[model samples]
Target: MTTSPILVTGGTGTLGGHVVPLLRSCGHDVRILTRHPSTDGVDHVAGDLLTGEGVEAAVAGAATVLHLAGGPKRDDEATRTLVRAASRAGVRHLVYISVVGADRVPLAWMRTKLESERAVAESGIPWTALRAAQFHDLALTMVEKMAKLPVFPVPGGLRLQPVDSREVAARLAELTLGAPSGLVPDLVGPHLYDLAALARPYLRHSGRRRPMLPVRIPGKAGRAYRVGANLSPVGAGAEVGKRTWEEFLAERLG
Candidate 1:
C-alpha cells in the first residue's frame, strides 16, 4: 500500500539518520520536521515541538508521523505538541522510539520518556510505542568518557543490553509502514553484560588499559541499575538483532 507523505521528527538524529533512509529506500515520501530548515537533502519543514511552531504545517496531510525527537528537558511538551498536531491533521499512525524500562528506571530522563508514552497513548491518534535498549554507540560513548580518567569508574553491578541504532531504526521503519500496535515488544541487544564487561572491548580496542573499577552508585537510580531494571530478560522480541556490542565497538573505535 502506498503511504501518504510520512513526516519524521529527529530526521538527523542517531536513529532518524537510519530510519529516514530506510523509508525513502522503500519508496515512502519522507519529510522531516525539524527546528532547522535543512534536512541535508530530504524534504523538510521547520518546526519546534516545544513551542508548537510550524508543527501543524509539518503534520498537515501526513499519513504517519514517526516521532523520534525528545530530550529529558523537552520530551513531555514535545510529545504533547506532536500528538495534538497529528490528531488535528488526522494522521493515520504515530510511531515513537523510546527506551526500555522507562517506567521502572529511576531517572528524570526515563520519567520524561514514560510521560511521553502516556501522552502518545492518550493522543487519540493510532500510535505504536517501541521501547528499545541502550544504543551501542551511547554505551561506547560512556566508556569513552570514563576511559579519559586514569582508572575507569562505573556503577557496580549495572548491566546493559546495548542494541545497534541501525537495527532499532529498521524496526521502527517496519512499524511505521504497518498498522499501529500500542506498546509493542521491546527491541533489545543479543547479549547482556555488566557495565565493565561492556566497556572492556572498547578499552581493548582503544589500547587504553586501565583498571575498570566498579563503584557503588547511591540512591534509587543506582539501585535500579544494579537490579537490572533496564534489561529485557525474557527476550520480548529478542534474537532479531544480530549485531553484537563487540562488533559495534570494533566498527566505531577500531
Candidate 2:
C-alpha cells in the first residue's frame, strides 16, 4: 500500500532542497509546492502561500506538511496562510522549521519565526515546530560575502554554533514522519565559536587575507546578540549535530 505524499513548502529552497530527497529515500512520496515549479525529481505543484493561490490544492490529501519557507520577508504571513490551508485540508501533521532562538532574539527575522510558531500552535492542527541553529551553508555564504571585502568586519560578542543544513534536514524528516509533539528541542551545532574565529578558516580556505575588525552593532538587538540569545544554552534539550564549521569549509573548499 502506498502512503500519501508529504507536502513540502519551499521545496526548492536550502533546507528543503536537502529534505525532499531524504524524505523520498525513506520510501515516501514527496510533493513540493513552489510558485514556479522546477524540473526536479519530486512532484512539483504550482502554488503561492502568501497569496493563498493553489495552497489548498497543493496540501490536499497529504499525510504531512513540512513548512520550511524562511526569509526576512513574507515568512510569518506565509506560515499563517499555510496553517489555514493545512487545517482546511485536514493534514495529519504540520512540521515547521524555525530558528533556534527565534523567541528570545530581538532580530526581525527571529521575531517573524516566533510569530509563525505561534500560528502553528494555535492552528488546532496536530503540529510540531523544530527550531534549529544557523545553517553552516548560511554561515559559509555570509563568510563568502565578507571575503569579497578588503577588511572583514566581525560582529562583537556574537557567537554561533552553525550546524549543517543536511543535519537539520534529517531532523525535520524524522519529525515529519513521526507524530506531532508541539515544539521539539533545538538541533544545534557540535561546538560554538565567535565571529572572528569562524571567519578565519573561511579566509584561509579561500586564500584571502584581511584584518578581522570587531564592530559593535549598536542598539538593543546588538545587546541581545552579545548576551547570547542566539546560542543554545547548556543542557537546553539540544540535539547536537556532528558536522563542525571547519569540516564544512574543508569539504566545500577542498
Candidate 3:
C-alpha cells in the first residue's frame, strides 16, 4: 500500500508519543518535528516552532500536518509563527489538537488556544480542530499538586468529562488521514464527575487524606465547565474509553 508522509509537531509529547506509533502502524510514513533529531524508527525533523526554525524543510512534501505545537503555557507569537509557516509551506491538511472550554474560558492558557484555533481557521488551509476534554492524566497531576497544599481548592459543581490521552491520540490520527472538516465535535469521556469528587479516589489511593474544599471559580471559563462545555453529549461520534478514574489511579499509584 502507498503511504503518505505526515508531519507531527510536538511529536515527543504524551499525546504525540501515542499518535506517532499509531500512524506508523497504519502504514503511514511519520515525520516528527522535534528540537532534537533522533532516528527512532520514524523520521525526526529538527526544528523549533517558536522561531519558525526549520519548519519549511520539516513540512515539505508532507500530505498532512498534525499541528500539536502549543504548550500548556501561553505564547501567542510562537503559535502565530507556526500557523504562518504551515500556510507558507502549502500543507495539504492541518489537524490541530485543542482543548475543550477554550472558546469560553477566560484563563490565559485557554485564551491562547482559542487564538490558535482562530489562526488555523483563517489560514486558508484545509484544517480540522479537535477540541478534547481534560486528560485523565492531567486530572491525576492536579490531584498530586493539590495534595501538597494544606487545603485542596477545586471547582465546585463543575462537571468534567475527562477522556484518556490515548483515545484522543487515536481520534486525531484518524482525522489526519481524511479531509479537514473544521471544528470537529468535542471528544469527551464516558462519565462526568465533579473535580473534587474525582480527586477523592486519588487522595485515598495515595494514602493522603486532605480537606477537599470546593470553590466556585468565578469567570466565563468557570461557567463553561459548569454548563458542560467540556462535554460533547451529541455531535460527531465519540469513542468511549474503558479506563476509569480508579483504574488510572491504581496504575499510577502502584
Candidate 4:
C-alpha cells in the first residue's frame, strides 16, 4: 500500500521538528508547510495560515494533517482560516496538539486553543486531539526570563507535568499513521513537580541566587492549577516521557 503524505503545519517549530522526522523514519511521506518557499528535503510547501494563503496546495495530496500552527498571541481568526482551508482541501485526518487544562483554563491563550480544538472537531474530518502538559523547555524559558529578578514570585502549590517535546511529537506521528480516535490520552512526564522546584536547577545553572517567593495568584486559573488541572487522569492512557526536568536542565545548562 502506498503511504499517503502527511502535511505538518508549523513543521519548523519544536514539536513539529521532532514529529516530521519521526514520520519520515516510519516510511511515511512527510510534507512541511512553511512560510518560506525553500526547496528542502521532505516536501516543503510555502503557506500562510493567517490569510489562508497557499494552504489548499499544501494539503492537496495529503491524507493526514498535523495542525500545529497557532499564534502565541492567540489569534482566533487565523485558526478559523486554517480550519476552513483544511476542510476545503478535504484532508482525511487531523491530529491537533493542545495543552493540558485548555478546556477549563482561564487564560486567553488556553481559551484560544480550546476554540481551535472545537473547530477541528466540527470540521467534518476525522480528528484526534492530544492535550499534553506544558513542555519542559517552556519552563526553562520561564526560568531564563525571570533569572535577573532578585525574587521569583511563583504561584505556590501548583502542579505541572512538563513532558518533553520529542515525546509529544512521537505520539503525533503515531496518530498520523493510525485511525483517528477523537481525543486521545493526555501525554505527561513521568513525575510531577512544583513550578518553584522546577526553577531551582535553572537558577543554579545561571549562577543566580534568588529567593523564591511563593505567592498566591488571584484568579480562577490559579485555583485550577492548584487542583492539579494540568495533570493526566489515572485512566487516560497517557504516555510516560522519559526525560526529567533535571535531565533537561543538565543538558541545557551544560
Candidate 5:
C-alpha cells in the first residue's frame, strides 16, 4: 500500500527547515505547500493559504497537514481557509504551532492566534495544537535592533521565555506523526529574562554600549505583560526547551 505524503506549510521557514528534515529522516514522505514555485526541485506544491489559491490541490491526497504558516496579520483568515480545504480533503491530522498566551494576552496578534486555535478545534477534523514561547531567533532579532540605538527604551515589566526553534520543531514533529491529540502543554525556555537582561548581553557581545531608558508600555497590553500574561503558568506541566539565550548568542555571534 502506498502512503500519502505529509503536507507541511511554511516548510521553507526556520522551524519548518528543522521539521521537514526530521520527518524525512524518519522515513515519512513529505510535501511542502508554498506560495512560490519551487526552484530547488524538492516536493513543493505552489499554494496560498490566505487566498485559497492552489490550496485545495495542495491538500489533496495528503493524510496529514502541519500548518506552520502565520504572520502578524490575517492569520485567522488564513487558518479558516486552510481548515475548509483540509476538511474537504478528509485530512486526518492537522497540527498547528502557536505562541504562548494566545488566550490570555490581550493583543491583536494573540486574538488571531486564539481564533486560529478555535478554527482548528471546531473544524470537525482530528487535530493537535502546540503553543510555544518566542524563539531564541526572534529574541535575538529584538535585542539586535535595540542594541543599535544610542538610547534603547527598555519596556519595563516585559519578560520572555524564549525557546529553541529546533526543540520546538522536534516536538511538533512528534505530534504530527502521532495520533490526534488536543491542546498540549506549552513549551518554553529554561529561564525567564527581562528585556534589559536580553539586550545587555547583546551589547557586550557586539562591542557596543548604549544607555538603557526604562519605559512603561502603557495601556491594557502593558498591564497584561506586567503580570506575566505571556508566560506559561508555573507547575502547569508545560515542557521546557534546553537551550539558553547565552548559548544561542555564543553560537550565533561568536
Candidate 6:
C-alpha cells in the first residue's frame, strides 16, 4: 500500500528547501503547496493560504501538513485557514514552525505567531509546534542592511540567539515524520549576541566600518527585548542548535 503524500507549505522557501529533501530521502512522498507552481522537479500544488484559494484541494488526500508559510503579517489568518482545511481533511499531523518570543514579546508579529500556535493546538488534529530562534540567514540580512547605512544604530539591550536554518529543518523533519508532540522544546543557538556583537563580525568580514550609535528602543517591546523575553531561558532545557554567527559569516562571506 502506498502512503499519502506529506503536504508542505512554503516548500520553496529557505527552511522548506532544507526540509523537503530530508523527507524525500526518508522515502516519504512530498507535495509542496505554493502560489506560483514551478517545474523545479518537486510535486507542486498551487494554493494560497492567506486567500484560502486551493487550500482545501491541497490538503485533500494528505495525511500530514507541514505548515511553514508565514509573513510579517496575516500569519494568524493564514494558519487559521490552513487549520480549518486540515481538520476537515482529517490530517493526522500538523507541524508548525514558530518563533521563540511568540508569547513573551509584545510585538504584532509575535502576537500573530502565538495566535497561529493556538489555532493549530485547538484544531483537534494531533499537532507539533517548534518555536525556534532567529535564523542566521535573517540575522545576516539585517546586519547587511544596517552596514549599508551611514551610521549603524545598535539597539540597546537587544540580543538574539541565531540558529542555523538547516539545523531547524533537520529538527522539523524529525517532528514531521514522528508522531505528534505538542509544543516541543524551543530551539536556539549555542550562544547569545547583542546588537553590536552581531554586527562586528559582519563589519570585519566585509571590510567596512561605521560609527556605532547606541539607541534605545522605546516602548513595551523594547523593554521586553532588554529583559531577554525573546530568549529561551538558560536553564529551561531548550534544544540548542550547534552553529555560531561567526561560522555562518565565514561560510556565507567566504
CA lDDT of each candidate? 0.88, 0.89, 0.81, 0.82, 0.93, 0.95
Instruction: Give the Cα error of residue 101 in candidate 3, in Å.
Output: 1.3
Question: lDDT tens digits, residues 1-254, model 1?
Answer: 25579999999789998999999999889989989867367889998999999999999989899999877586988999899889989998999988988889888889899999999999888899999999988988788888899988878868888899999999999999999999988889888888788878787888879986769989998888888888775656644478999998878766
Number of the predicted model whose TM-score against the real structure is largest: 6
Q: Please give each candidate's TM-score.
A: 0.95, 0.97, 0.89, 0.92, 0.98, 0.98
Of models 2 and 6, which has the larger TM-score? 6
Q: Output the better candidate (4/6) by lDDT.
A: 6
**Model 1: residues >4 Å from true position, as ranges?**
1-3, 233-240
TM-score (C-alpha, index-matched) for candidate 6:
0.98
TM-score of 4: 0.92
- Where is model 5 more than 4 Å wrong at Cα? none
18-62 in candidate 2: lDDT tens per residue? 998888888999999899898867789998888989999999999
RMSD for all candidates, in order, please.
1.6, 1.1, 2.3, 1.9, 1.1, 0.9
Error of 4 at 180 (Å): 0.8
- 151: Cα error in model 1, Å: 1.2
Residue-level lDDT tens digits of model 4 in 1-254: 24678888888888887887888887788888889756667788888888778888888877888888767765456667777777888888988888888887688888888888888888899999889898988888877877667888788768778888888888888887899899887889878888788888887887888888878967787787777766776776887889998998899789
Model 6 CA lDDT for position 222: 92
What is model 2's C-alpha RMSD?
A: 1.1
User: Residue 87 of model 6: what lDDT?
Assistant: 93
lDDT of 3 by residue, 188-211 (tens): 777878877787898888788888
State which candidate, 1 or 3, has the greater lDDT: 1
Superposition TM-score, candidate 1 onto the true structure: 0.95
Regions of candidate 2 where Cα sits further than 4 Å from its true position: none
